[model samples]
Target chain A: MKKIALGLLQVAGLTVFSLLVNTLTSLLHIPLPGSIIGMILLFLLLESGVIRLNWVEVGASWLLAELLLFFIPSAIGVMKYSKLLEADGLQVLAVVLVGTFAVMAGSGVLTGAIYRIKERRSS
Target chain B: MITGLLFLGLTIAVYLLAKRIYASSGKMYTSPLIITPLLIIAFLLMTGSSYESYNAGGKWLSDLLQPATIAFAIPLHKNFKVLKKHAAEIAAGVLSGTVIAVISSMLLAKWLHLSGDLATSLVPRSVTTPIAMSISQSIGGVPSITAVFVILTGVLGTMMGPSVLRLFRIDNEIARGVSLGTAAHGTGTSKAFELSSLTGTISSIAMILTALFSIGLAPALIAVFLH
Candidate 1:
C-alpha cells in the first residue's frame, strides 16, 4: 500500500510540475516551447537538488519509455483524410519517403562534416 | 465497443512485433513509431473500419505527447557539458542544416508547381512536432499534413541516419545527435539515445534549436519566396 501510494504521489507530482511549468510559460508568452520550458524548469529543480533524481526517475522513465505510443493516435489522424491520401496517395508516399530520406541524408552529412572539421581544429 | 477491443489488441500485437524486431536489428526502422503506424494501417485494412473509429481511442494515447516531450529534459540535463564544449559549432551546424532543408524543399515544391498548400506543408519538414505544426499553421499549410511529414521524417532519419553518417565517416556523438535531431525531431532523438547518452543529449538540443530556427525563419522565408 505504501509503495503504491508513493508511486502515485510521484506520478502526480511530476504531472503537476509539468503542468505548472507549461502554464507559466504560456502565461509569460515565452517564445520557447512550453514543454521545453517545463523541461528546463525540471532540470533546474534537479540541478539544485530540490527534486532528487530518484524521486522522479520512476515516473519520468515510465512516461518516456512509452513516449512513442503517445504519438500513435496523432499518426492515426492521417486516416481522417483518407480520401485525400488515397487520391494523392502516391504523391504523399513519394514526398514522405523522398523528402524524409533527403532531409536525413542532407542534415546528417552537414552535421557530420562540420563536427569532423571542428575535431581537427580542436585536436 | 468491439472496435476498442480490436484496437487494443492490435496495439499490443504491434508492440510485440516492434520488440522482436528491435531485439534483432537494434535499429529505429523497427521502432515503435514505425511499427505502430504500420500496425494501425494494417488493422484499418483488415477490419474495414475508418480511421475515425481507430482514432477514437488512439487520440487519448497521443495526449501524452506534451508530457513525454517535457521528459526529454532529463536526458538534456545529463548532456549539458558536451553541448557547452561544442556549443558554437553545434549551433551553426544544426541552424544551417535546418535552414537549408526548409529552403530547398520549398524551392523544389515551387519548381515542381505544386499547390500553395503542398508547398506550405513541406515548410516545417525538419523540426519537431509542436513547432512544426505551429509553423505550418502560420505559413498557411495544413497542420495535419505537416505533422504526418514530421513523423515520417523522424522515422526515416532514425532508420537511415547511421548509414549516412558512416558514408561520411562522421562518428562524433555531438554530430550524430545534432543531425538526427535536426532532421528527424523526437524520433531521431530516440535513436540518438540508443547510440549514447551524449548523442541523445546533443540530439535533443539539436531538435530544440532546429525547431526554434525553423519557426522563426519559415514565416520570413515564405514571405520572400512564396509571396
Candidate 2:
C-alpha cells in the first residue's frame, strides 16, 4: 500500500513537471511540444541533483513500458479512414518497414565507424 | 458517467487481454498495442458505437502520455553518465539515422505518388508516439494516420533492427542501441532495454535527440515539399 502511494506520488510529480513545461512552452511560443520540453526539464533536474532518480524510477518505467496505451485512441481513429486504407495501406506499411530498416542500418554503421575512428586516433 | 466508465473499462480489459495472449501465445502479430486497438475498432464497428464515445474514454487515458513522456527523463537520467562519455559520436550517428528515416519515408511516398498530406505524415513516422503525433500535427499531417505509421515503424524496427545491424557489420552496443532508438523510439528502446541497461540508456538518449532533431527538421521539409 505504501509502495502504491509512492508510485502514485511519483506519477503526480511527473504530471506537475509536465504541466509546468507545457505552460512554459506556450508562454515562450516554442514550436516544441510541452511534453518534450518537460523531458528536457526533468533531465536538467536530475543532472542538477534537484530530483533523485530513484524517487520516480518505478512509476516512470511503468508509464513508459505501457506507453502504447496512450496511443491506442489515436490508432483507433484510423477507423475513420477506411477508403484511404483500402487504397494505400500496403504502400504505407511498405514504406514504414523499409524506412525503419534503413534508419537502423544508417545509424548503426555511422556510430560504429565513428567509434572506430575515435579509438584509432586515441591509440 | 456510467457509459464513460464502461468504455474505459472495456478498453483496458481488451488491452490487458491482448497482453496476456501475446505473452502466452508467442505470436508475432498479437502485440497488445496492435491487437487491442484492432479488437476495439472491430467491436466498435460491430456495435455501431461512435468513435467519439470510445475517444471520450481514451482521450482521458491518453492524457497520461504527457506525464509518461516527461517521466522518461528518469531512465534517461539514470543512464546519463554513460551517454556523456560518447556524446558527440553518438549524437552524430543518431542525427544521421533520423535524417535517413525521414528522407527515405518522404522519398518512398513521393515514389508512390502519394499526396502532400500523405507524404508529410510519413516524415515523422519513426519518432516516439507522442512526439511523432505532435510533429505530424505541426506539419499539417493527419495525426491518427501518423500515429498508426509511427507504431508500425516502431514494431518493425524492434523486430528487424538487430538483423539489419548485423548486415551493416555494426556490433557496438552503443551503436545498436542508438540506431534502434533513433529509428524506432519507444518500441526500439524497449528492445534495447531487453539487451542491457546500458544499451537501453543509450537508446533512450537516442530517442530523445532524434525527436528533437526531427521536430526542427520536419517543418523545413514541410515548407519545401509539402506546401
Candidate 3:
C-alpha cells in the first residue's frame, strides 16, 4: 500500500512538473522544445535536491522501460501514407539506408577522432 | 469496442516479442525500437487494417512519450560533471554532424535528381521522429516517410554503433554515448545505456544536442537548398 501510494505520488509529481514546464514554455514563447524544457526543469529540481533520486526513479524507470510503446501511434501513421510510400518506396528506402549509414559513420568517426585529440591534450 | 481490445492486445504482444528478441540476441539489433515497428508492420500486413485504425488505440500508448522524454533528465543529471568537462567538443561534434547530415543528404538527393518530395523526406533523417515529422511537415515533406527514415536511422545506429566504435578503436564512454545519440537518437541512447551507465548518460545529452541542433539548422538548410 505504501509503495503503491508513493508510486502514484511520483507519477503525479512528474506529470505536474511536465505540465508546468510545458505551460511556461508556451506562455513565455520559449523557443526550446517543451519536453526539453521539462527535462531541464526536472534536472534542476533533482540537482537542487528538492526531489531525491529515489523519488523519481520508480516513475522514470516505468516511463523508460516502455519508451517505444509510445511511438506506436506515429509509427502506425505509416498506414495513412501507404499510397505515398508505395509510389516512392524504393527511393525512400535507398535514402534511409544510405543516409543513415552516412550519419552514423560520419558522426562516429568525427566524435571518436576529436575525443582522442582531447584526451591527448588533457593528458 | 472489440476492435479496440484487439488492437491493445496486439500492441502488448508486439512489445513482448520485441523484449524477448532483445533478451535473446544480446545485441542492439533486436531492440524494441526496431522490433516494435517491424511487428506493427507485420500486424498491419496480416490484418489489412489502415494505420489510422491502429492509431485509434495506439494513441493511448503515444501519450506516454511526454513522461518518457522527461525521464531523460535523470540520466542527464547524473552525468552533469562529464557533460561539463567535454561540453565544448561534444557541442561542436553534434552541431557539425547534424549540419552535415541535412546538407549532404539534400545535396546527394539533388545530384541524383530525386523528386522534391523525396528530397524533403530525407531532410530530417537524422533527428528523432517527432521533431523529424514536424520538420517534414513544415518543409512539405511526407511526415510518415520521415518517421520511417528516423526509425531506420536509429535502428541502424544502434546495431552498427558498437562495431564501428570497435573498428575505430574509440572506447571512451563519452564519445560512444554522443556518437550513438547524435546518429540514432533515443533508440541508440537506450543501447548506450546497456553498455555502461556513463555511456547511456552521455548518449542522452547527445540526443538532446542533436535534436536541438537539427531543429535549428534543418529549416535554414532546407530553405536554402530545397527551396
Candidate 4:
C-alpha cells in the first residue's frame, strides 16, 4: 500500500512539473514543446544529482512503458483522414518503408566503419 | 459523457488484451500498437460512431503523453555513462541517419506529388510518436496522420531491421542498436533489448539523439526546401 501511494505521488509530481513547464513555455514563446523542455530540465536535474533517480524512476518508467497505449487515440484519429489515406496511402507507405531501410543500412554501415577506424587508430 | 467513458473503457480493454497477445507471442506483427488501433477502428466503424466521440475519451489517454514525454529523461539519464563513452560514433551514425531520414522522406513525398501537409507530416515519420506528432503540428502537418506514419515506420523498421543490418554487415552491437533506434525509435529500441541489454541501452540513447536532431532539422529542412 505504501509503495503504491509513493508511486502515485511520484506520478502526480511529474504531472505537476510538466504543467508548470508547459505554462512557462507558452509564456516564453518557446518554439519547442513543453515536454521537450521538461525532459531536458529533468535530465539536467538528474545529472546534477538534484533529482534522485528513485524519486521519479518508478513513475517515469511506468509512463514510458505505457507510452504505446497513450498513442492509441491519435492513431485512431487517422480515421478522420480516410480520404487522404485512400488516395495516397500506398505512396506514403512506400516512402516510409524505403526511407526506413535506407537509414538502417546507411547509419549501420557508417557507424560500424567509423568505430572500426577509430579502434584501428587508437591501437 | 457516459458514452465517452464507455469508449475509453473499450479502448483500454482492447489495448490490454492486445498487449497480452504481443507479450505471449513475442512477434512484431502481433504488437499491441498495431493491433489495438486496428481493432478499435473496426469497432468504431461497425458501431457507426464518429472519430470525435471516440476521441472524447481517447483524448484523456493521449493527454498523458505530455507527462510521458517528460518521463523520457529517466532512461536517458540512466544510461549517461554508456552514452558518453561512445558519443562519437553514436553522433556520427545518428547525424547521418537523421539527415537521410528527413531527406529521403521529403524527396519521395515531393516526387510523388503529395500535398504539402502530407509531405510535412512524413518528414518526421522516423521519430517517436509524441515527438513526431508535435513536430508534425509545428510544421503545419496533421498530427494524427503523422502518428500513423510514425507507427508504420516503426513497424517496418522492426520487421526489416535485422535483415537490413545483416546485408550491410553491421556486426557491432553499437552499430546495430544505432541503426535500429535511428530508424524505428521506441519500437527499434525494444527490438534491440531483445538482442542484449547493452545493445538496448545504445539504441535508446541513439533514439533520443535522433529525436533531438530531427526536432530541429525536420522543420528547418522543410522550410528550406518546401517554402
Best by lDDT, which number? 4
On the 0 to 100 scale, the lDDT of residue A41 in model 1 is 80
- Please name the candidate that would achieve the greatest DockQ relative to the true structure: 2
lDDT of 1 by residue, B16-98 (tens): 67877887987656777777787778778887887777866666566566667777777766667777888876788787777
* Model 1, runs deviating above 4 Å: A1-12, A29-33, B1-9, B25-29
Fraction of native contacts in model 1?
0.51
Report the Cα lDDT for residue B94, model 1: 81
- For model 1, residues A1-123, the per-residue Cα lDDT tens digits are 776677667767777776787778888888666777777787888778897787877666666666667766666666666677676656655665566556656666676676677778989
If both were scored by lDDT, which would come out higher, candidate 1 or candidate 4? 4
**What is each model's TM-score for chain A?**
0.78, 0.84, 0.85, 0.89
Model 2 misses residue A104 by how many Å? Answer: 1.6
Q: Quote each prediction's TM-score.
A: 0.88, 0.88, 0.88, 0.88
lDDT of 3 by residue, B1-227 (tens): 56766787888788888888888987666777666777777878798876667767777677667777899888888879988988876787777778878987788777667788878888887787777887788878988777877776766677777777787666777777777788788877777887898888887888888888887788898888865
Give candidate 3 regions above 4 Å deviation: A1-9, B27-29, B137-144, B223-227
Model 2, B33-110: lDDT tens per residue? 678878888999999988888887878777888898787687777777777878987899999988887789888998
Query: How big is the positional error of residue B22 in model 1, measured in Å on the Cα after superposition?
Result: 2.6
The Cα error of candidate 2 at residue B196, in Å, is 2.8
**DockQ measured for candidate 2:** 0.68
